[model samples]
Target: MIRGVLEMGAAGFLPKTASPEIMMGALRIVLSGGVYVPAQAIASGSEMVLDRLTERQRAVLRLALKGMPNKLIGRELGLSEGTVKSHLSAAFRTMDVRNRTEALYAIAKSGARI
Candidate 1:
């Protein structure tokens, strides 16, 4: 649910059980152009960073995660190598990762289901 809300571009989410102080903090963060994702959502594995990716980016990432090289990933996806690289760059940025290893670690840490 949290992932879905975030995927829809919501700046933050607060459960009904949130205390007023927590809600106020979340609101303040959102108002200041920040995104607030509660630790509970992350702990529960509902804060998938991949939720920010487009379908093509996810497809590219899926193959890349399989240890496929860029050329092969592009060939399999019917995209040019440059296109594949572009998608990966965008995906890395969206996931706030610096490289494939970091992206993989982040994905694993988030417990996102591919």
Candidate 2:
């Protein structure tokens, strides 16, 4: 339900446990066209997750954040295209996002530097 609301541009995804005041504020923010996802939806303390990334995954994500294609990223990292895809799959799972773009969004939203 929360995910559906968020995807529909409802602006916020708060747990039912949120205070009334918090809900009101979230509603206002949503009305103003701002996005608000609950902390759970984002991997907060994401620097820890960042640190947990393998060196290759970090490199791959950084390049991906720059909009680099897999082929180019592989070339730069001296990894095969298959290896790059494998790394991307692992990264997507770790980041809890389905795709590269969502991964970047999740990482930034979690307050990670990159």
Candidate 3:
């Protein structure tokens, strides 16, 4: 896992043995635009695949990640509802995910910056 983290150029690697303070620090780093890798890969057993998105797709996903509704996202991005849906579908396809929950898991597990 450490090897993968280093190879992926992630921001941090934390072992389960780390203290609560250290874990919190890792979360803070991740929240502040950094990556955090655990002692092992995610139990979901998937490789980090955050690099697979286009810029637009990444933007949409970021809004989605913030728990925005499709309508709100459309309004904020100056897009139509249908276009938002289209972008969402394309983003899901690009991430190979079936739904928002799965996409969120992938994003968190991958430590995706977008």
Candidate 4:
């Protein structure tokens, strides 16, 4: 896991703990051919082996990435907004993340690429 972190650092994979603002800032630097690591993340570990998400979680996440709100996602999935929130919470836990942005980042960084 540590090795994966090191390699990710070398290859530029930001951890899921990064705030959306920080992530966007880091992304700008990366896009300019520079690698940016958050100072607080220096001691953070790698995201190794994310178990495959359930079909429901994946469905919710797919819409979430498309910028859908939980209410809309629930409506589309024929689930309650509360149920969508629960699935999102479980997805965040399974992805080792805190927010939707971080989960999306982790998914991308982990090579799932949405």
Best by TM-score: 1
On lDDT, the stronger of 1 and 2 is 1
List ranges where model 2 is wrong by over 4 Å.
Answer: 1-48
TM-score, every prediction: 0.59, 0.58, 0.56, 0.55
Q: Choose the strongest candidate by lDDT.
A: 1
Q: How would you encode candidate 4's per-residue C-alpha lDDT over 38-112 as one tens digit per residue?
A: 443332345433446788987997676555778889999999999999998888888788775565456545454
List the global CA lDDT of all models: 0.73, 0.69, 0.67, 0.65
State in Å the error of residue 88, model 4. 0.2
Query: How close to the true structure is residue 98 of candidate 4, measured as C-alpha lDDT?
Result: 76
lDDT string, candidate 3, 1-114, tens digits = 554554465555678788998799677756655455442443333445556677777787677655566788899999988888898898898889876546655665675456
Worst 10 residues of 1 by lDDT: 38-47
State, as a TM-score between 0 and 1, how close model 2 is to the true structure. Answer: 0.58
Q: State each model's C-alpha RMSD to the native.
A: 12.9, 10.0, 9.4, 10.5
Q: Give the Å shift of residue 2 in candidate 2.
A: 19
Evaluate residue 83 in candidate 4 and report its C-alpha lDDT on the 0 to 100 scale.
97
RMSD of 4: 10.5
Flag regions of model 4 displaced more than 4 Å.
1-50
